[model samples]
Target: MASQYSDGTLPSGNIGRDFYIPGLTPVGGEDEGTAFDMHARQTRFNFSSNTTLSNGKALKATIELDFMATPNGDERVSNSYSPRMRIATIEYDGWLFGQTWSTFQDVSVLPETLDFIGATDGTIFVRQAMVRYSAGGLSVALENPETTVTPFGGGGRIVADDNGVPDLVLRYTLKQDWGHISAATLIRQLAYDDGNAIDSTETAAALSVSAKVNLGRNDVRMMFNTGAGMGRYLGINAANGAVLNASGELESIDSSGGLIAYRHLWSEQWRSTLSYSWFSADNDTALTGMGVTESTRSVRVNAIYSPSKELSFGVEYAHAQRDVENGLEGDMDRLQFSAKYAF
Candidate 1:
């Protein structure tokens, strides 16, 4: 996808941590205005294989990569970039092992858009190493664990990788002829230890519900999530999972996010999608400071045309806004174009 960010200088960086300049993201500078970029950094590919066993069981495996989350390259000479791992997994007999999409996320409800992640600010979007078990519609997983925290009275993020227990998730999906719905639960630990001013651990939990409902040749998608210490998994780390108090203790932040989209098939070769996403954090100003983000939202619309199943072209328009606890607000507008072909 090629993108043109306007009305603001959306400086490029790790879209996940920096949030595609969405929620809880700090303004880069005072003169944030229009800028442009045209690239294929979003390109991705994957390889899959299936093997059958003598006992009639089948093993499936896949490995995928994309040019995101890696170190950025200069655009002057070569514009070279590194490929980041997206997924590497193997499944057999209702068991999955390796790094893949988090069990807490419902990928089926995501809308098709030119941006890397259509509902980033309001969706459970995570990929991590795990061991999962599935039977029928129920699934359980033990995923990697880490926590992000903000220093007392406002400071940059501190990724406290000090957890011994993995994050646990339980999900159930109900499928019907018309569509499917999923509900998931996440239980995690938030820990930090600076050895000087901070050393604490806390437990947190969250829940997410998502659905895709069919409407003849069209469909509607939605998701809603609420919890404490799940910010990193939700809005792409728009807000830290917890904040440090005066006593150097971890306090999980309460937050919520949602996404809704509608897709309509204009014809066999034409389709369009409109989507909106939102995120909010309930933070104590005394602990987290008034400069932190309080809320964020975005709306986007796109049209895609595919002459064949393997080839497609698309364009999208998006507007995003964020509000700080101190009452400051910022908004950005963007336009993107994309083309894709697969073999």
Candidate 2:
């Protein structure tokens, strides 16, 4: 179970608990007070199998689940949530299928923290269905695509599921005795249709790099990503993929995000990490107006203790801030504690 006590309230998705988010952390309101909550939604389990094929090749399958997306029941009642799929995959002969982490993200670059996503603001955190092929250190795949857009004056948001093209990704990794490094690219066509005269598509591309370097018992992890129309692929969808121009045509948005973290071992069973993350969107005020989010950032520190490989406890403190194009800003401070047992 995990618990958090914050100086400010969180946005919806209490399922996410108190995990830090860039643009959504604070919306700049005076309704601030002590906010506290606890949940076990991040608890998860997995099932896997490996078998030999008729040709003597190995085939493996995995299905994992957690209740992060289950509708929270009334705490006054059952307070039980159902399971949801996190990853389900099949791999054989250098080929993989099903839903998993996006090729654009390096799972190893994720930092260790009590929050659901440690490096929340500047990580390429995405998971979706795809077909992938791997050879040596190179892998490529085409993934699911959806576009989020803001109207001409930024009244609200429009999630356009009218993409005519899938997102394409290519990644390569380098591993050595010290650590590992990875770089990837994503290409997609952002499309939208209002069934009127507003049907169009815009092509956009992005680049991401991540690495982990080991220094004896201490280590460092980092990631950087930038592109046009990055959209939901970066910083937990902190920015939109595109925006509708006055002509009702699609125009890709420009954005960048990155993170860095350092971990130190203090004793056999104790460790600590310090990290910082940020996300920025180059929104055209003429089109998006002053109400949309412009940038967000956060800093966090955590300490963890593990008496054994399967049992661990952690505590983290995080400070996050959000800014809008119109100069409105809000910041929050949060402290969290968690305990976990893994089998």
Candidate 3:
């Protein structure tokens, strides 16, 4: 179970939006008032199996699901729930095939918080279908491809025309007795063809570096990511990967973001984390539109108590701000409480 109270304007997805860009402020209107909500949608379930192959190897498969999807806005009356797929993967030898965390992301370096992803605005948060190979802390993958584009006039978005190419990602990690470090790179092709003589294509690329250091009972985690046209890959799709210029040509956006978190243990069963994240994008207002998001930032602090490994309780406070290219800005502050039990 969880309860959340938010003050000020926030984007869709409620608390989940805290990690992404804030929604634009209403024209000539003040930000929204305080809002409160509660639910038990974070409960999840998992299934897994392992089989031994004839060649003395092992094959593993797993499927995980959670009830986080809200349909038709009937949370109070229907208490509606939908099964959301979190992970479905198969692994054999050093190869992974199916949907899982993106090759560009390092979950080990993520901060601990009640919110889904602590550093929403700065982290590479993505999960999709891919074929990956791993060997000695090095991994490479070819992931599913889809391009998001802001139209020339910029009222809505358009899907890029199919370009028979998948995203390419490479990552390497170094683990030491004191800490660990990782670096990754991604490249993809963004294309669009309206079929009415408007056709365009652009190449996009991104880089990420992450690290975690141990200090007795405390630790530190951090990540930095930057790219051109890294749209849906970073910042939870806060900006388009590509947008049409005034001449109807495709162009990628430049963005950079990073996060730092520190964890402290007050006792054997009580601990806390303090984290900060920020993201900024260079949007060509004359080409994309004035409504494009310019920047977003957030701060989070949380404490958790675990009587046992199966049950835990936590409380968190988060503050976030967003700015648009047109100079309009909005901010949000939220308090969240959660209790969970694992079987």
Candidate 4:
């Protein structure tokens, strides 16, 4: 997607993290001017194959890639593109192993939009190495683990620490003719060893529920998620999962988020979706560093036209608000357009 910003600078870092709005303005003589950008980094390639095992079991594998590298700070000369891996997985019988979407997320209920993630600020979005087993409408997984933490002082930046155990997740789905409902639970072990004889560890957990209802030619989708120390998993890591207190102990933060969306059909070739998302974190000012994000919300509307099953075009408008723990707030507006073709 190509986007133009009117009020504030676009968020930096990982593309997924960029989906969240920033709560603080540019400081230290930094630029806060309007910006325009156009790119086709969303284009991707997919390779898949299926086979039958000697034991009469089915086997499948897939690999996906795209060009969304950071440009290495040289956007003026070479716009050099690089291939990045998005998914690589193998399935045998009812088991899956490798890297793909998190088992805690329900991709089927996500809203459609021009941006990479339509309701990212409130959505459960992540991809990591994992081993999962499925039966009927229930699934379980053990995923890679990492913990993020903030120092006791208010000026230090957040840092990630290695984990001692993997994350565990359980999910179940109920399907009917009119709609479907899904629920998931997650448990994690967070650990930190600063090599300064000040080591700490903590346990975190979260819950998520989602639903989609079909109304003839239209539909409604919704999701709600809440947890303690669910940092990088929800809201694209807008807040640290845990913080170091004055005594150098680990303390988990409280967070909640959700999104609601509706899709309407204008004709056989045209359709539109309207979505709104909200996310909030409760951080202790004395424990967490200052200037941390307190809350974020966004609204987006888009229209898409598909002349053929293989080609489509879309345009979207979005507005977002960010609030900081120190009472500072910022606003952002964006216009995005995209064209996609699949083979």
Candidate 5:
């Protein structure tokens, strides 16, 4: 009756199983027969550069190194460096220091899929360390507030503490010919006394727009975004583990939204993109006690094939659900396949 009845707890004993626990085992021990250890070789190397400074001013950079592969010895380094920087100061109407993307919306309607680090609601924002400006197109940003804190119930249990707030931004963009429109406003600073006197001040506002259309061969991109108490293009709070998003209220989870994507480039080696997103957590006492809930929905589909140009292949599927008024339910579904080569 034990075809594999340990550490693989899934029929509802509550999710577990990624076995292999030596070193005196005791975190839900299993594998009494022993003999299975080999799988932890991760490799990564990346370099990026873009320089054009003869007065047009532009500089971009990315460097990453991660390693771990061993047979008997040698080649065992965890990190040489992981750096990302984008230095910009160009003229034609836009320029100014560090971090990128946040013009508001219309990023080519986004979807190349293969999940190159994104695309499931796809509105991730980063590159902080602020200072930004863009003319004619209208853009403004001043940001700094990357915070973190982690520790979870152990010994005395019932310990849940998390706080996040670091923001100051204002953005505006409008580009026509059928795509691009943006709006953003934010001011955040929260965490007071008990958490160590950080004071308090919060305000959030957001509106994102996107557009692209070409019916002849099928190419369509559409987008919409909204924020109520603000902060949540990519939110985090995993039941209080806090990677970011600390009850500034994420606009009270009144997250409004929209996304529709369609891409077809059938001849350039085939292509496909189908997307969907809808989040309307219309406020429920603002996620009362931080237990979380207002409303949630997510969907994704991606397909890719690029016969040449750095090679490619892909497949993806995702599903999400969140509904709580105290009934409680959080869900996720994923399926993925990928292949790629680039230099």
Candidate 6:
């Protein structure tokens, strides 16, 4: 496999929280994490070509390989290898196998943002071991979830759980002279079956409608999406008590949210995006005595500029607050900026 860092492409970074520049290839392929905080990050290369086999039948193959850096900044060969075959089964009729985005995600409606956190939460399942079929712009997918987690501050035994199981999705799309429109629904099961013995079976669903509008010199696009789900987990713990940084000590919670965005291309040399999102989790009824109920809400706005097709930059401001009833601490805030170049 050959690695090409420059191709004016953005590899998918929906697997984790990492803003990606549209001009640069993803630091790694979409299969791994791109966040700087992760203990490991991967970079991949791909080489695909076609050849004629036995009976004049043309056969095609793609070789993909990824490189990873350890937390200690060490690179090892033992940790890297060629990607397995079967990411797709039959390419005909839009049938897919191995790994790919779920039908539930309507990426066309998403805005271009430099903040990794700004991408839809649905992108995380882009490629998984699964099978799917599509026809007449309608697609259905069944695949396992790609779970991820990070140790906050790297000291406590407890961690934020982004774990989920293989989910089922159904999607429909309509294409027009200007652009396209899409909608989807989904259901998933969570992996964590602990804490208060609450239900680990989670159901996630989303709805969205968007379109591209052309107005002579300027082109505009917009999207609106909302989703809801449940899982046994903790997003925020209050600073009220002498908290033991141990697992099974925190309360689990449920959450729901929505996102909206707008993009305008002023000209060939200038463009930008404005986006807003809010998320809130329900308090744990079982942990009523634990002194805290978990919930959170946040909103953000961003402006992205593309000086040229090869270079891009962005700035963003966000305000977020998390509240836990009778719990450890109150709330916090976040602000971010980013830039990238594509070869």
Q: Give me the candidate number with maximum lDDT.
A: 2
Report the Cα lDDT for candidate 3: 0.82
Candidate 4 regions exceeding 4 Å error are: 1-8, 11-32, 71-73
lDDT, candidates in the order shown: 0.85, 0.87, 0.82, 0.81, 0.44, 0.43
Q: Positional deviation of 291 in candidate 6, in angstroms?
A: 7.8
Off by over 4 Å in 6: 1-90, 119-127, 145-166, 189-254, 287-297, 325-337
State how far residue 13 of model 1 sits from its true place (Å). Answer: 5.0
In model 4, pairs of residues that clash are none
Instruction: Kindly list the per-residue Cα lDDT of model 1 for residues 1-343, writing each as its tens digit.
Output: 2333332354564353222547633443465565566778778899999999899999999999988655677778897888989999999999999999999999999888878887777988999999999999999999999899999999788988899799999999999999999999999999999978677999999999999999999999999999999968988888899999999999999999999999999999999999999999999989999888888888999999999999999988887878888887777667778899977
Across 1-343, the per-residue lDDT of candidate 4 in tens digits comes to 3333333455543343234333332222233445566667777999999998899888999999987665433457765678889899999989999999999999988999888787877899888999999999999999999888878865655575568889999999999999999999999987778888658989999999999999998999999999998888887787778888888888888899999999999999999999999889999998875578888888999999999988889999887777778766666666788899989
**Stretches of model 3 off by over 4 angstroms after superposition:** 1-28, 70-73
TM-scores, one per candidate: 0.94, 0.95, 0.92, 0.93, 0.27, 0.56
For model 1, the superposed segments whose C-alpha errors exceed 4 Å read: 1-8, 12-19, 24-32
**Deviation (Å) of 86 in candidate 1:** 0.7
User: What C-alpha lDDT does candidate 2 achieve relative to the native structure?
Assistant: 0.87
Between prediction 3 and prediction 5, the one with superior TM-score is 3
Weakest 10 consecutive residues, lDDT, candidate 3?
A: 19-28
Off-target runs (Cα >4 Å) in candidate 2 are: 1-8, 11-17
- Name the better of 2 and 6 by lDDT: 2
Which one wins on TM-score?
2
How good is model 1 by TM-score? 0.94
